[model samples]
Target: MILLRLTWLSLLNRKATLLLILASISISVFLLLAVDMVRHQVKDSFSSTVSGTDLVVGARSGQINLLLYSVFRIGNATNNISWQSYQEISKHPKVDWSIPLSLGDSHKGYRVLGTSQTYFTHYRYGKKQNLDFAKGKPFAGLFDVVLGAEVAKALNYKLGDSIVIAHGMGNAALVEHGDKPFVVSGILKPTGTPVDRTLHVSLEAIEAIHVDWKAGTKIPGLNISAEQALGMDLKPKQITAFMLGLKSRLSVFHLQRSINNYRSEPLQAILPGLALQELWQMFSLAEKALMFVSALVALSSFIGLLALMLTSLNERRREMAILRSVGARPMHILLLLVIESSLLTCLSVLFGVALLYLSLGTLSPWIQSEWGFRLIVQPLTLWQWQLLGILMLAGSCVGVIPGIRAYKQSLIDGMAIRL
Candidate 1:
């Protein structure tokens, strides 16, 4: 108890410098933990968005492009699959369920996904699962809207509210769908995928809104009422892509090959898991860059802590003389310094974690609203915890230099050392 109090007093005496050290270490720990968590999660998020699905089939493109456009809503699809091709694949014997998707538009920066009700009933993310509705029911009729959890919360949308859709694949200058508006039919539970930020409506809704348009612009002076739209056949001509689940997992490669060599128009089929792996490989470079940058920041912080303690040691020489005369051993003095530093490091790590979670909890709604990215404050994984422990140990070890110097100075000066 006496020794612990001595260590406490020593750090308390230099409160200003110690506080700076604490702040630096805290920022470093926070950044290290945050970067590690984000790198793992972004990849996990991308891969988890569509699991248990055998393949994602779309018009001819690279595997990475197909996955990004269909699953992540990252980029627009270069070509769309005809509705006839979707039906033909659905008829295959090994197929269990197929969800067709129509893309190529946005509303206030939110992705507009035109899909059948099976998307809510059968589509899964993270694990093999179905869409969970947080409020209201799924789309029931043409022009009905189903907001993602993020979309609903961010936009403050609820059931029966009306909203206008925008034209084009991005934040465009004009409101093309202003002539036609949609009623909020439902809001989905949070799934933490692109789905959470997407706006889901029926394929018929896609057809109805786009019937008179060509090449992403309205055919001039060609306007029709919602009633007239309802009267026309609402079938889709071209869909951006489709997801396929197989009755037999073993037949995935065979199905992929079949789709790749379709009779008339060329098509490409990508295994969701395989395509996800490819996508991750492409993104790994960015992850490495972030990790490297965060590591350098941590290194600088630890060095700052070391420099502060060493510089402050000069003022403590007389204090050390007093302690040596009072019968404190060299090891005891060394341990006092180590305990102070280790405790400070541990506190910084804990405080940093708290601050990170607090920030995320507060800003999560805003981030999802504007960025279409969900930030999850998950506890450190085992490996991540281990990495942090190693950093803490390294920081503490670096702190030992001051303790060693203090021990030597106390022994050599024999109660006469003066700063």
Candidate 2:
């Protein structure tokens, strides 16, 4: 009871100082956890984009460029592997199935991926998961197009709705495929992958739309209508790249090496996961800088807590003397001070966690749309708890400096009040 009474009295005596302590802890905890959550989300987004695929084969280029262009749809390919080349590679005896990808097109900033039905079956993102239909089924015909969750919601597209593709990478409004509109056939569930920001169509549909087109021009006014193109053979002449799955999981390394050594061209096959790691290596410095900033913010907040505690130590001496006169030992005084510090740190963590949760709850949609990655917020894992626990322990040590000063002041000015 005395300890409880002492603790309350100590806090009440200097409410302003304690409030400062609370606020400092709150900010530090918030900074640390926020950095952690975002970093985790970044990695999660990368790994979830593509997984379990054996190889990504494409025209002559570095492994990094192919992954960026085909998988992430981040840039345009310098050259295309002829669809004939893709067919030949797909027919290799060791190959299981392959999905051709045609890029350099968009629908209102979202990527347009020309692939086969095998894509829906083979593509897995985030935990080896297959795409689930949020609404409607997979495309069944050539003109039937599938929308990703973000693409459908952002554009307000539904089954049977028509959307026209543009002939560029981004938000440019020129070169619209106004002549060839696609009917929305399926909408995929939100997977938080690049698929969430992509439109899926048949390779034949891609070929059909550009059949009479040449290099950003309409073939000198010999325009082809959608209906007429359908009647014409729609075999793609060239493709950006193709994703390959091997016949056996064990043969992936061997096959990737084989494709990398293909005789006809300087084609490259990359392991998707490894390519991503190499890609992220480019961001290593930035990530490290982020960590450093987070650490600095957290450290500054903790120092603010320490300063507040030290500033209040002089005023707290009298309170400590009274407690000691009334049978509370110096050790009791020490525990009280330590307890206050611990309580402040605990409240800060709780408030920080609460703030993170509340913010994520509101910001999830904006994060998914603007960043193409979902900011998944959940309970702290054991590792996070361990990190937080360490923070608390370190904080308690910082409190000792103030606690020692209070003890010495109380002993020197026994039974006397001094500011």
Candidate 3:
């Protein structure tokens, strides 16, 4: 108890230096924990982007590419599947429900998705959570549209507001369907997924808007009015992709094989779970790189702490002499240094956790709006607890070097004072 009191008094005497060390370690700890927590949450969010679906069927392409374009809205599909193929596969004995996706359109930088009302009834995210509307109901008419929360907020759209669709898939669109405007029927609650940045419309609407468009441009002098287009055959001939839920989990592989080997146009069916695992594996390298950089930052902070204590040792020579005069031994000085180092590191852990909570609370909503990532503020996980223990142990090891030097200097100074 006396040694602890002495150590506390010594740190108080150098409060400025102590605070500097505390700040350094605290910042390092914060970065390490933040990186770890964000990495885990991002992986969770990615996996949760589309749940309750067994397979994603699309034109022949890489699994990751299909997953990214279909579920994440990250890239354009290289090819599209024929509506005939979609119908045949969707009617399979093992298929329970299917949701068709029509792409290749945009509304003010947000991807416009062409799907059926079954999307709202069957689509799931973040567990089996169904889509919920913040205002109004799903699209009931051919020209009605449903807006994602982010899309609605960005465009300042409300129910009954009219919005035009662009022919292409970005903000810099050249040809827009200005002649046929769609009314916003509903706005969805935020899902923290690609769905949150999409605009939903009926597949017939997609075909209707493009009735007079060909080769990525409006057909010269070939104008089709919205009323005429709607009355025409509006059935979609091709779709970018489709998601399927199987009646039997055991038949997923069999259905995947059948779809892949179909004699018609080349197609691929991927198990969502398998594709998600592969995606995570692809991201593991980046996550490891971030963790490595954070570990280096922590190492540098501990090195600074060691140097600070070692440099201050020379100035405290007289203090060591006074301690020895009061019957303190060399081992006592060593233990005191270790205890001080442990206390500083423990306090840094606490401060870092507090900082993380404040940062997450402040940024969660903004992040969800901009990036569609929900940063959950929760208690540490088992792995994070292990990491804390490792950090504490590592800090103690860092103290050993300065502790030995302090012990040696104490012995030398005590003998000189005795003489």
**What is candidate 1's local distance difference test score?**
0.84
TM for every model, in the order presented, reads 0.93, 0.94, 0.95
Q: For residues 191-292, could you state the per-residue lDDT of candidate 1 as single tens digits?
A: 878898899999999989988898877899999878899999988998999999899899989888999999868899998787777777787898889888
Q: Give the whole-model CA lDDT for all candidates, comma-separated.
A: 0.84, 0.83, 0.90
**Sorted on TM-score, highest at the top, how do the candidates line up?**
3, 2, 1
Tens-digit lDDT track of model 3 for 1-419: 99879988998999998898899899988999999999999988998889999999998989999999999998989998999999999999999999999988898778999999889999999889999999999999899999998889877999999998888877783578999999999999998888989999999999999888876788899989988987899999889999999998899899999999989999999988899899889888999999999999999999998889889877877787888888889998888889888888999889988998999999998888777788999999999889889989988887788889889888777745433
The order of the candidates by lDDT, greatest first, is: 3, 1, 2
> Candidate 2: which stretches are off by over 4 Å?
none
Residue 308, model 2: lDDT of 82
Q: For each predicted model, how many residue pairs clash, with residues at least 3 apart or on different chains?
A: 0, 1, 0
Regions of model 3 farther than 4 Å from truth:
415-419
Pairs with backbone N, CA or C atoms under 3 Å apart (clashes), candidate 2: 48-126
Q: Please write out the lDDT profile of model 2 over residues 104-218, one tens digit for every residue.
A: 7889989999988899999878778998998888888878899999999998999999989888878855688888988999999998878989999988988887887888767
